[model samples]
Each structure stands twice: as structure tokens, then as C-alpha cells.
Target: MIVHDTPLNSYYASTSWIINITIRKDNWALTKTIQSLSFCTIPNDGFFEGIELIVTSSTTPSNGDKVVIHYYGRLAAKQGWRFDSTYDHKDQNGEPLPFEFVLGSGKVISGIESAVRSMKVGGIRRVVIPPSQGYQNTSQQPIPPNFFDRQRLFTTIFNPTRLANGEGSTLIFDIELVSLRRRRKL
Candidate 1:
């Protein structure tokens, strides 16, 4: 029997991982032990409490820097409930144009600002944000193109604060930090 212990640093933790196991005829005795060990379990409701962040790539950008990103937003409670996207804005070459904003700026939502602040250029992250860090009021940007879709979103799950029932709304964002540049000093 052999045990391979891999020490993972904070940097390595941001990336994905894959575990593979190989067994020979002689290892059949250990197969029962391995099979007994549970590998992964996904929840039926697909709801994870609080913020969940998965980093697909990693890079570091400083505050006050101008950064560009591509993102898709959805309602966390509803599967396939994509509310808004930047994909509509594309260049003449047919490439999706990224949204640009300064880090730490109030232009975007608090959740987005918080997520992008820790990201590096070319880093992609999926973040689930609770109402506390999400939209407390109507945001002018990223509205759905279809009137009915927009109405459904705003009426149902967009702004928790605006809802009379006081139910909370959680949002999920898949964000990719495309590039960043240092803030120019005067």
C-alpha cells in the first residue's frame, strides 16, 4: 500500500483538480474499500447557502486598475434562468465585447466588484452571491432585451428590496477577467 500526499498551496487551490485511480488484479482486495468511499454528491435542489466561488483560472489585479470582463448572470434558485449577458455587444469581427470598469468602482454590483477584485487577468470565476451583496435596488445596466423577460425578472427575482414579501434573491455570475491595466497617475 502506498499513500501519495500532495501539498496544495493557496495558489494551487484556485485551479481545478482531477483524481484518477488504477487497479490491477492483485488490488482487487482493496477495491471494496475504495468503492465504499464516497467521491461526490450533488444536492437535489441545487442550492448552496451563502457565497460559492469556483475559479477556473487565476491571475491578480490591483484595485483602481481598469479591467475588462465577460459575464453571464442568472437566478440561483431557478435552473437555466439566465437573466442578463454582455454577449449582445459584439465587435464587427463578431467577437463578444467585454464590459470594462475600474476595480473598486461603484459602477457594477457589490458582488461583482468583490469577485473581480481578487481575480487576475485571464482568470475565470463562477460566483454565487446572496442578496446582501447583490442588487438592493434596480440597476440600470444588463436588462433583458425582451420586455416580457425583463418584466418577469423584475417582478419575480431581480430586486429583493423592492419585493413586498421581503423574500431574498440570490444571483450566480460566471465571470471572466479578460484584461487589466494599471491606473494612470496624474
Candidate 2:
């Protein structure tokens, strides 16, 4: 399976204010539904992030092994709040961002690490990670200047799978598990 990595650019800075109004309106509608459903509260026991995902793959990942992941999900705000995408941006050298990560490693965020670990080859599960676990107090990639200071960031990882190496970080990929080859020789 070939995985294409894309840069997460700042969506907020690139778009005009007029376009944001429509997104904000849609976000408001979603927020209302979540509030009514009561699936809006933050999780206390598991990861503190407000996001969860169900991931499925064919091969399982071991510790210290670099597993490539390809995924696509959305970000939403917590209860009584909203996701201001205008301020949040993640891009590579000069491109819109796509999902890619090395499993079981700290290369990404804590929430992502936890969710990916709980997945198996061809398995899917929902992971809830609060803002604390998602991005916490970081002001780096994905999270823009004003958006980084906020309290939480939530995302749901859809059907995801492992990818091959040597792929550039600019391709939005739909990956499949080719195989899980061991690095050390027997």
C-alpha cells in the first residue's frame, strides 16, 4: 500500500471571511445536535481529548515499529464551544494537509498514539481524546496562532490502514495493508 503524506496548511488564513460564515453556521447546527444527544461531555477515565475514532487495518503494530497510517476525519468543538478552523492550519512546504502518521511513536500527538495502538489489522474502533490529549499546550503544526491557545481539539479517525515508505508528505492517500515485515533478521 502506498501512503501519500500531505502538508496541513492554515485553512483560516487562506480563506476569506465570507466563506467562514457558512462553515460556522454548519458547525453551529452540528453542535446543537451533539448537545441534545449528550455525547458532548468530556471523557474523564480514558484520554481527555474530545475526539474518538474507529480504525481498521489488516496488520497489528508492535512497539517501536513504524506503521504508516492513512486517514481522513473532521474536527469539531466541544460542548458549548466551536471549532474555529480559521485559526487552525497545518501545511507542509506549501500544500493542504492530509493524514499520515507513524504508529506507536511520539511523532504525532498523544490522542492519536492511543487510538492507533488500540487498532488491529482490518479492525475499527472509536477513540475519544480530550483537548489535553489532542494538542494540549502546543503552538506548532496544524494549530494556528490564535487557535492554538484554545482549550480543546477533537477529531475522528475513519477507516485507516498502514502505508509504504518513501512517499512524499503531500499526497492524500487511500491506503491498504500490504504486509508487516520485520526489521530485524532472524
Candidate 3:
């Protein structure tokens, strides 16, 4: 995404502003015009800092909204090795269950919360979370049911210190926002 301010001209009064944005992706280019400067809230690079985000949806969740998401998490240090996944979890009826959380509730890691903040229902995103925003402590939720994998995860995360300090691996999560519920007013 490239953004540049349009030169002041007779067509556009001084009171109003126009911003030209050019978005380019492999072999295709799109140009968008914003009539107001208020829309300039987007960062110059068109993305948030710290984590890489690939958005496949056009909608975003708001604060206090409840969200259901399915995720597959892997450690960057061990490429192709999955540390945890919602797909591996199932109920007694053999139905898959996604994780649920309210936005801004701090039920999940900061990276996940940040990533989910911009997602729409049925949208899938792949996020690369830095160690600082990843896991400072071991997470118990979304744990693998396999006994061997579970044991390995526990020992690796906890041994007098926390996981971030122990492994310090960058986390990559493929997340899908399954459902969303707006918060009700009191």
C-alpha cells in the first residue's frame, strides 16, 4: 500500500483533502481515493507494527464482542511442528469445538488478541507473533490431548522458568474467526 497526499487544487477546496492510495499485489494494482483526511488513520505502511497479518476478510470485530475462533499454532523454531491446535480437540460426540473469547478480555495471549481484533467472521488469518507478544507463561488451553505431545509441551514450557524465557520461539498461528456476537448494552 502506498499513500500520498494530493496537491491542493481548484477542484478540491482547502477545507477538504484527498488522499491517493495505491495497493499492489502480484500482477494487479488498485487505486483508492479517500475524500477526507480523517481516513488517514491507516499507518503509512498500511499495517500494524510488531506482527505480520494477512487479512482475508473485509470486516473487523469491536471491543467487548465475543468471538469463536479455530487455530493451529506452531513454533517458528520448529518449522512444520505443531505445538497446539483446536482441530485435535473434540467433544464426546466427536464434534470439533473452537475456542471462544471476548475481545479485550485478556483470556488469550496479546498477539492473538491483536490479530483477532481485525478479523471478520469466516475470515482466516496467519499471524507471526514475536516472542514478547507470544507466550510469557505456559498456556493450558488448546492443549493437545495426545499424552506424549502433552508431556513434551509441559516439560519444555515449565522447568523453574516460563516458556518465553525457556524456548523464546516465535509463534505462528493460523486463525479463523468462526462466529461473533455483539456485546449487549447494560
Number of the top candidate by lDDT? 3
lDDT of 1 at 17: 35
Inter-residue clash pairs, candidate 3? none
TM-score of model 3 vs. true structure: 0.61
Q: How accurate is candidate 3 locally (lDDT)?
A: 0.60
Assess candidate 2 and give its lDDT.
Answer: 0.33
Cα lDDT tens digits, model 1, 1-186, are 010122222212434333222212212422211211221111212322212222335566777898888787787555648877666556787666678888777767677777777666655555666556666566634466668767776776654464656666667676767788888888
Each model's lDDT comes to: 0.57, 0.33, 0.60
Rank by TM-score, descending?
Answer: 1, 3, 2
TM-scores across all candidates?
A: 0.61, 0.37, 0.61
Best-fitting candidate, scored by TM-score: 1
User: Least accurate stretch of 10 residues (summed lDDT) in model 3?
Assistant: 37-46
The per-candidate count of clashes, in order, stands at 2, 28, 0
Clashing pairs in 1: 59-120, 60-120
**Judged by lDDT against the true structure, how good is candidate 1?**
0.57
**Cα deviation of 165, candidate 3, in Å:** 8.7
